[model samples]
Each structure stands twice: as C-alpha cells, then as structure tokens.
Target: MVLRYVRRHFKPLLGIKGLWTFRHTPLAMYWAKLALKDMLVETVLKDENLPPDVTNAHWIAHVVSYAGYLAKIRYEGYDTNDDSKTHWVHFCKDLYRIGYCADNHLPIVPPLNVIQQKQEWREWIIKRVTGGYTMHALTQQLIAYDNDTQLRKGTEVEVLDKFSISRMRVGYVKEVIGHRVHVRYWDTDADDQDLSNSFWCHEQSDAINVVGWSKTVGHAISAPAGYDPAEIGNSSVIKKNPGVNIQVGMKLEAVDPLKLSAISAATVVKVLKHGYLMVHIDSAGHALTQTYRGVESDANHGNNRFCYHVTSPLIFPCGFCKENNIELQPPIEFKTDNFDWNEYFKATGAKPLPLKDLEKEVIDHGFTEGAKLEAVDVMEPNLICVATVKRVIGRLLRIGFDGWEDNYDQWADATSCDLFPIGWCQLMNYDLQPPHVENQEPGLKPVSPGVKRIKSKSGTASRSKRQSATSSSD
Candidate 1:
C-alpha cells in the first residue's frame, strides 16, 4: 500500500520541485558561480593569500571578533556560569559581512554575556586567526560584497557618531546547497502534495466526534451479566454439585432416583453473552449458572466473576462418572460430573500477579520455583544440552557464500542452503558438466561423454617412450 501511494504521488511532486529550483532564483545561481570560481582560483594560484597589511589586519580582527561571537552564542547552549548571552553581536557581524557594513564602518558591538574561561576563548580566537580559509569564508565574502555594493550609496562611517551601519534588507539567509541557492515552487493545488488544507482537517475532526458518540451509545445498550435467566425456557441442563460454580459450556449428569448416587444420563448447556444457564433443581425453583460479571472482584477473571476461570477444568473421565478412574460400559451414556471449583478459585486468585514481579521470581528460581524449570529441564538436562548442540551443528552445515562468512556457523545449516539441485546434482556423485551439456541442441557439437581423467600425484606428467626419444633427440 505504501509503495502504491508513493508511486502515484510523492515521486512526481519531488521531480517537478527539483526542476524548478535552478530556473527561479538569480541570487542562488550567482552565489553558486562565485563559489566554484573561488575554488578553482585557490587551487591553481600558489600565492593567492591576501597580504597582511594594517587595513587587512583590521578586517581580519573584525572577522575573528564576529566568528567568536557566533561560536559563543549561536552554536553552543547557554551556561549560567558563562557570560555568552549576547547573540545579536554575531547577528550584526553576519549582517556586516553580507554588504550591510562598509569600509571604516564601526559596528556598535552591543554589550551581552561574557564567554568565560579566558584560556579557552583565547585558543579559539588563535585557531580562527591561523586556520586556512574555508568555504564559509567564501560565503562570507559574497555576503560582504553584496552589502558593500548595495548599502553604501551615500552613508559614510563617522568615528564620532554611533549610527547604525546595518542596512540593506537582509531576508532570511539559508545556506543553500553548500553555497548555491536553489528555489522551487510548491503548488498547494497539486494532487500529490500534502499541503495544510482546511478540508482534510475539518473532515478528520468530524470523524473523531462521530466515533466518540458511537462509543457512548454502544456502552448504554449492552446488558450486564448474571441477569435473571428464568425468562428463558426449559432450564433443565444445569445441575447443582456441592461447592461448584456452574459456568458456560458445562455438561451435567443425571442421577437415578432408586440408586440415589448413580448418574443416569448427560446433557450440556450453552451460555450466551451476558446470559446465564438456568438450572431447575429438585427442590429449588431455579438456580443461576456462571455468567459474565465486570465487578472489581472479577478483575482477575477477565471481568467475568460469576464464571469459573476456564484454566482449571473439572475433568470427568467416563463423562458420566465423578471418579477419576472409570470403566466404559454398555447402556450408560457419557457425562461430566466432577465439580472442581477450588482449582478455579486458586488459578483466578493468582492471575493478578504483576508481570515484573513474576519475571523477577522466574529469574531467581525457575517455573518449578517460577522460572522455566519444567520437568523436562530438571530431569533431562542432557537432552536439553544435546538439542542445543544439534542446533549449532545445523548452523555450521549451511555456511559459505562470500566474504560475509563471519556468521558461518549461524548461517550454514539455515533451511535455505543448497549445495546442488536435485536430479543433476547428488550427495555422492553429481553430473556437473556445464549448461551447454545440460540442454543439448541439434546443430551443436555432441558433448564428450564423461571422461575420468587420472590426476598425477607429482607435479610432472609421465612421459611415454616415443615422447622421451623425441625430446632427447631434439
């Protein structure tokens, strides 16, 4: 589904946006051209570095001051002990670099937080002064040139008057693709584009409101469990056994009147959602069976308190007998009679143990003691060990593909591995001549019927009598 959506929408939108970038923006294109020229000149010219003079040194000082300002404020996070709070100092310098400040233009460096640890700040300044020119310097140069050409039409730098040298409309400067600027139009009308449209938001908001109302209505109509079951018919299948809490899908056995204790026949009762299996007893008018209940007491039993938890089942061996050991006989039908309510209660009580606490206990002492201490693990440790060994052996059998054989044993006997194909390749002897022999053509030369070549043990071929005589004569 994701692939289908991307193919239909995202790919085409990106392609169109990418194409429009170079066509629309002039400033973006010029900056790109300037950067490339600078790179070429720097590489070819040996002595391209500007000479160190008084004016040049002053300009370098300003650049260093600005960079230090930026490093202290923009990049690093704030520290209470450090006084590097003035971010605007760097802002004015950045503006100055991009034609906003002219020659002899003294910027009013605003007072801000001071960067602490004199030794560290001094080292940072030294590095900036000595480090070779970077791509950032080239970008700054373009900004400085643009500002000088555009901003200084008539204004002069006065040593006496502290006026704003920061002029020239500085729109947000994005570092577009190293130094080049690329602009593209994003059409809101495009089908593939996901613009912040009011239509989608409005529709989604309405859907959420409807869902909230629906959930409220659903809760109101639902019936509670253990409601009176006398309204429903018959109620004959349910039989009361001492201490047993009758539940859904329970089978009962009928007892013979004369025998008193011997059961005669069996029957099952099916329970419905929030419905009870009503049993008609000999003396009692009606008795309720286990039904769904959602009280706090029923929390461990999946919110079904009246119902006995299914984990502990009351097993009736012969189906009609209450005893564990029973013999199948003629005429008598099978039934479930034994009522083991104690097992259900125990299981239900323990069900609410927290997962983390249970896990901790398991880690400390296994399942027999609550970890994975099954009878198999405790009684047959060697079998478990053998199983682990076989798993390792299987992994080793399927190894060898390429340089990525570091996981050799792990990947070797993977179900996916195959040494050879069936019919052509066998375990002992496989006919692996070539593809040409496998599919022989009419016009093609008949492939030589398999030949068993004898390999020489020593690195030399045995010479025949005639071949030896010819070699000696030569």
Candidate 2:
C-alpha cells in the first residue's frame, strides 16, 4: 500500500523509470528508500488532518527505511498481525512527535504517570529519533545509562592538561553540547572565587576523565579546591598508555602525509612522551622555513612535517616497502625506482629505530575484506556513513563509503576511532547518513580488484601494480 501510494504521488518527482534501471544495485535502492523517508518526514507526517490508515501506511514505510529493511521488505514484502501493527503504529506516532519537537526547537513534554515506568527509555528513544547527540556524548550516555550514573551539569571531574607534562585539573561540568563538554575550572588563588576559566572538549577525550583518574596514574592533580582526591574512584574508561621507546634522529619509511599513496624516507625531529613523534620527510623539495630562535629551520616547514605515534601503521622500518615489493617514493635526489636504503642512511647518518620497539606497538585489528561497517567521513566529520572494507594493508584499512565514488575513499588505521562496528548508529540513536547516489553515473563499470588506479600529475587515470601481502605486518 505504501509503495502504491509513493508510485502514484511521487513517481514524477523521483523518475520511476530511471530509478528502476538500478533497482538491482544496493546503493540505488538505499538511496530511493532515504528519499522516500525524507519526503514523508518533511511533508506527510506534518499533516495532522491526514486519515489514520493513510498516515499509518506512510509511517510503516518510514519506519522500514529508518531500520534499513527497505531492501528486504521491497522484495519479500512485510506481514504483521493486528497487535504488532497496532504497536508499531503507536511507536511510529511517538517517533513523529519527537521529530516534530526537534524540528520546531521545542522541549519534549514529559510522559504522564501511567507511562512513567518507561520514561527513561522513551527519553533515549527521543534523543535517538532527533539525531542531535554527538558520537562521544551518545557513547557516554549509553555507558552512564547502563551504570545508572549519567554525567550531567555540576558533575565534578578532572580534565587532563598536557603542557611540558600531564596534569589533572579539577573542574565541574558546566554544559554538554553533542560531543563537547564545557568545564569550569576551580581557581584556588583567586580571592573572589572566580570559576570563569572554562573550556570545552570532547566528552570521551583521553584528556577528560572522572575525578580520581590522576591518582590511579600517579599523576599530581593541580587542584586548588582542596578536595579529597582519595574519596573519588577511578574513571570507568581506561586510558591508553602503550609504551613506545622511539627517540629523536630515528629514521623510518613513512607514508607521505600530503600524498597518502606514496611512502618516503622520514626522520624523527622531536620525540615526545606517550610514543608520539614529529617526523620530517627527507629531501621533500619544499622551501625551508625559520623556527623559534632558528632552532630547527627545516622542521618549520609545515608540509614536510607530520605527527604520528611511534607505533603508527604509516611508519615502518627502512626496508619494509622494498621487502614487500611495494613501490616507494624516494627523496628528491634519488631515482624513484633505484633508491637504496643502505646508501641513503649511510650518507645521512640516520639510524633506523629497532624492529623490536616497533613490533610492540603493532595491533591485531582482525578486519577482513568485504566486511560492512559504519565509518566516520574524515572530510565531513559529523557524518557516520555506511562503508565497506575495500582492502587491508598491515594495520591499515581502505574504507570505501557506500553510494560514493572511489575518489572519496580513505585509508585509515585499523584501530582508528573513526571506524565503528555495524549498527553503531542504531545502538547510539544517531541517524546514519544515507549513501549518496546522485553522483553515480549510469552504467558505471566496476574497477578490477587486482589493479589499483591513481590520478597522475597530468590529470589522467594511471594504474599502479598492487602487491598483495600474506601477513598483517607486510
């Protein structure tokens, strides 16, 4: 009935014949369902005078799309008994009301006493349906909900401040907007008791933690409030403190940060705590810039330098690419095809970090090809879209967003927080952005998996020989 209604009323708007050409394609079908759902939410659900049966049919369609079951239902058709249908209608009506409130920027009304037992669950549903919470906030809320200790305004916590070293400062939660939390610091020196020094950060940031985190880590708290740190318990979320023993002047082959496809010789210019290193690409052919007090002239060039944790998958031992039969982008002076690691290191007086140190940081991601997941669009940070693991390279993953062109695909670390498990959006009550379909051309040919294509300097498509590695370290 919903499909019949859509065909009759929206056929001209959606070009039914043209859409049918790609009915077999998952991207096309998903795009169509998203279009239908948006139309119903923006138009059909807003009409209060619409008949119950008609509204119910449209609601059922919208629900199906939201749940991502449109593809199966379109072909298999859905059947429900009278009781199930009634329950779904009520649920859909609630979803519509929540959406309406969000659209109008109105506060949601509390439920009556009769339905108070499920009030908390309903509020979570409201947040999910409205799609207003950030990923961090949603995850925190889920954790809090399970633990029955939701963090709200006035919650005392410790915020990590990293300067020359790390210090935990006492602060109170002022406000939470999406993933950002405004923390008002307690000033001990101010006689007037000013609490105006506040800043915002992601709720799940490693820098932010429960009140007693500093004690567990043996870090001194910069608290002026004279509060008893001993009374507070450790944070629920454990901080990642992996040991990495990299030092300055260490040489490694790293993926060029600017041109991600190329691997080049790099030197660590600065070594910081917690396995982080500031590496400068060798002989990058970029202009040298002056640094503070002329301390490191070459390091001042922003394009030539990149920050990476010592255990990063992008950085590897000197001869890694050569041993794996992968192409390497050598320094400007060396021939790309004939670059020798031994001679290059000898002339530069560069020492490669021991393989033992690098091995400790290597993680087993357990990701396989063709697996479906929700991945954050790095270019568009707010969007968590449907994606597939197109390829995996040693601790690196090639993520291709669904319904998007290959040009938008990105390479990410296997342990990157940007990648989430399937159904994460649903579990968090966040709305997943539908795969974009308008950009896809008709009769598009799929590229062969055996070859990798890259755009050359002359703006032409060129194929690169892709070598498959048997081990994750390769």
Candidate 3:
C-alpha cells in the first residue's frame, strides 16, 4: 500500500531509481512515512504556489534539507544536538499555525519570541553549513564600522571641539583598553609627546570617527599617516586568499596543528566562509563512517578535529607525504606499512582539494630548527619561558618549551607576537623564567642563554610542581 501511494504521489519527485530502491528496501515503511509528512508540510502547510515575494524558495529548501538531514541521522541511530530537534519542532508548529490562520481567514501574526526563534534557527543552519560568518554577519560588522563604534587603541577619529561645537577636530586615540577612550586632539598646540591634554570619554561615544569612517558617510576627510582612504570602501574585510574552492568530504594530508611533528590523513568536515575549514584527522582512531554522527560533541569525546585556512601550509595534497618522504599517519583501519592511499580514497569516496587553490606565495621568517628563543606560554599567559624552535614548516614554527615534555609544545606563526627575540625580556625589564630543570635527564644542565640544543628526550613533570611553579610565577 505504501509503495502504491508513493508511485501515485511521489513518482515525479523520486524517479525510477528511487522507487526501485524503496521497493527493495527493508526501510520502505520508514521512507514512505517521511515522504507523506514532507508532502503534507509542503502542499498543505507551506502552500508552494504563493508569490515569490511571500515565499523564499532558497530559505524553504534550507529548512527542508536541515530537517531531512537530522531525520536521516537520527534514523541511523546517531544522536543529534537537542537545539536542532527543538528548532525543527518549533518550525513545524509555526507552519501549523500559519496554515490554521489561513484556513480560518484570521490574521497570521506570530509572537515576537516565535519570530526571534525563527531568526535563531536561520542563523544556526547558516553557521552549520558555512562554518563561519555569513553575509548577514559581514553586514553587521560593516554597520558597526560605519557607526564609528568598537573603537580600539591607535584609532584616529574626528571629535567635536569642546570650545567650538560646530568645528570637528581630528584626534588620536591614545588608549582604549578600558571602557573609555583617551583622546588627544591633533589640532591642539599641546606638545606631541604630551598626554596631559588628552581627555577620556566612553569608547563608543559619538564624538569619535576612527579614521576612514568619514569616507563611509560621504564626507571628505584627511587620511591619517599610513592610512589608505580607498581601503575603507573595500568590502573584502575577511582575510582570505583568492580562488580557495574547498568543500566538505574532500581528503588531504594535514599536520596535527597541536602535534606539529605528526602529519595525518584528514577530511574536510566543514567548509567555512573565506577559505576556512574544519577538518577531522582520520588517524585519531575515529572511523570516517562516524564523521557526521555526533560531531557537535566530538571534542569532548577525544576526536581530533581542527580548523585551518585553506591556504595553510600545514595541509597538503594527497601524495604530499609520499613525495616528501615524510611519515603519513593513516586511518586506524589502514595502519600497516603497506597502507595504500589509492585504496583509502576509493573506499571513502574522498577527493583532494585542488592544488591550485592551495598554492600561495610562502613568506619566510628565517626561523630554523633547534634555535633557542623566548616564547609566551599560552597556558600561563603571564609567563615568558625559554623555548626552542622544534620544526619550521613554511611560515609556521613548532615551539617546544625548553626542558618540558612534547605535550607542552605549541605551534605558532613565525611572525607571531607571542614569540620574542632572545634577550627581549631583559630589554623590557620582564622576569624571564628559565627552562624547568626537574624534568631533564640527570646531569643535563638547563638550557643556557643563546645556546642551541638538539631535541631533548621526552620528559615528565609532576602535576603539583607544574601548578605550583606556574602560580608562583604568576
């Protein structure tokens, strides 16, 4: 009976191959039920014949796709996030309300909270698909920029003169780390080196213009030194390389950003806007078959997923490790010495991100392996510790905290502000922590200033001592 109903009602939608699959499938009843619900929602509740102004086809498609994806995942015995399920139920209720109102000739007015819920649903779906900011988010940022709000230190703004309210005076934002900004009018006769004449006001006060802002409002303004007025009108605010065309499910080799020494087989789980990607390292012991199932809580469950830009030097084409004679950490199933990349790709239906998209000019920061330097400990932000350059992959530097275990190592951009030249701490009058000696091998002296050492053996530190030392330094 279900098959007959589908043949008569959904033949055009499913076509011949789909009908044959449903007929032969054990889950025919389930598919038929889902089809019936979707049909009712589309034909009865949604009223697809409505004018384009009244109905958005793209939005409706996204809603339907989201519902279908969730239902399919649930049917496959995977747990989805509660918020997703709740939103779907709320959407169905909203559709029912609209249909009921139309049938009774009553006004269709949803409560403000219901309206807000729909907006939230829209945003959630976009985030899930895009993995980052959408056009709406970019627009909001532009609005904030145009309003001359969210001012930061070093911003140059135009302020209304206190003595003459009609006159607008250019000013430099001396400080804005706090809730208020300290401004010094450039038109004043006060000495350039003097901050005594600077005045403080709310950071978002209308009295500032953050340089380039006046150009947005059709006003002629003087550009500050090293400021380009043309840059203010450019819409490409997000820092993304051109021609990055990555998609979810594509396969590539990626360095474990945290474990910089290991490169593993990876899959693009999410393709975010502006060339960003959320990739899942397959060698982390999780099967690729379970990639989409329970992804929201993967981190808590010890899954190795990391976000990287498309042009990041850490990610490479499928044959990269083989060509470079580097060790490739394959998925758990293919952990043999004879692991085959071709077989893995065929089994998983994974394609490599095009090499053209990944190609970009590499910047050289001249950092070499085994070089000693000072680095800020990310975990203990206040502490600057002696560190060694462990690996230099393109513009990225793997920094190993000297005398510490490999687990405490970190990867940073070569030009990162977190790293400083040797002796920078002494120049700045900051107390620099020497390499921890407790974890070192017996008779191995602590790393001396300006002395380079080979990679040390993995060492361990007691949790109590580590915590105590970090706290005392703080």
Each model's C-alpha lDDT? 0.20, 0.47, 0.47
Give candidate 3 misplaced runs (Cα > 4 Å): 1-237, 257-261, 285-303, 378-383, 393-396, 428-431, 438-474
Query: What are the TM-scores, per candidate, against the unseen true structure?
Result: 0.15, 0.45, 0.41
Residue 53 C-alpha lDDT in model 2: 36
What lDDT is reached at residue 3 by model 1? 16
Model 3 scores worst on lDDT over the 10 consecutive residues at: 69-78
The number of the candidate with the highest TM-score is 2
Per model, state how many residue pairs clash: 16, 0, 0
How do the residues 28-86 of candidate 3 rate in per-residue lDDT, one tens digit apiece?
Answer: 22332332222212112233323234432212212222221111111101123432222
What TM-score does prediction 1 earn? 0.15
Choose 1 or 3, whichever is better by TM-score. Answer: 3
* Per-residue alpha-carbon lDDT of candidate 2 for residues 1-474, written as tens digits (9 for 90 to 100): 222222233322121111222222222223332323222121122234233333321221223232222211110011323222211121111333214445565433322321344446445544444643111213233333432325687898887432111245787776554344556666533232222245445565444778766665454567765566663343445433366557788778886554444567777877654455667776444224322111223434344566565666667888887887766667666655678889877887777865445454555555667655666554333356667777777767778876555656667676555665444444445455544443334432222233444554423223221222111111
Q: After superposing candidate 1, which stretches have Cα over 4 Å from the reference? A: 1-22, 30-112, 119-123, 132-474
lDDT of 2 at 212: 64
lDDT of 1 by residue, 117-216 (tens): 3335435544543533323335545434432321121121111000110111111111121111111112122232211110111111111111112122
Better of 2 and 3 by lDDT: 2
Model 2 poorest ten-residue lDDT run: 69-78
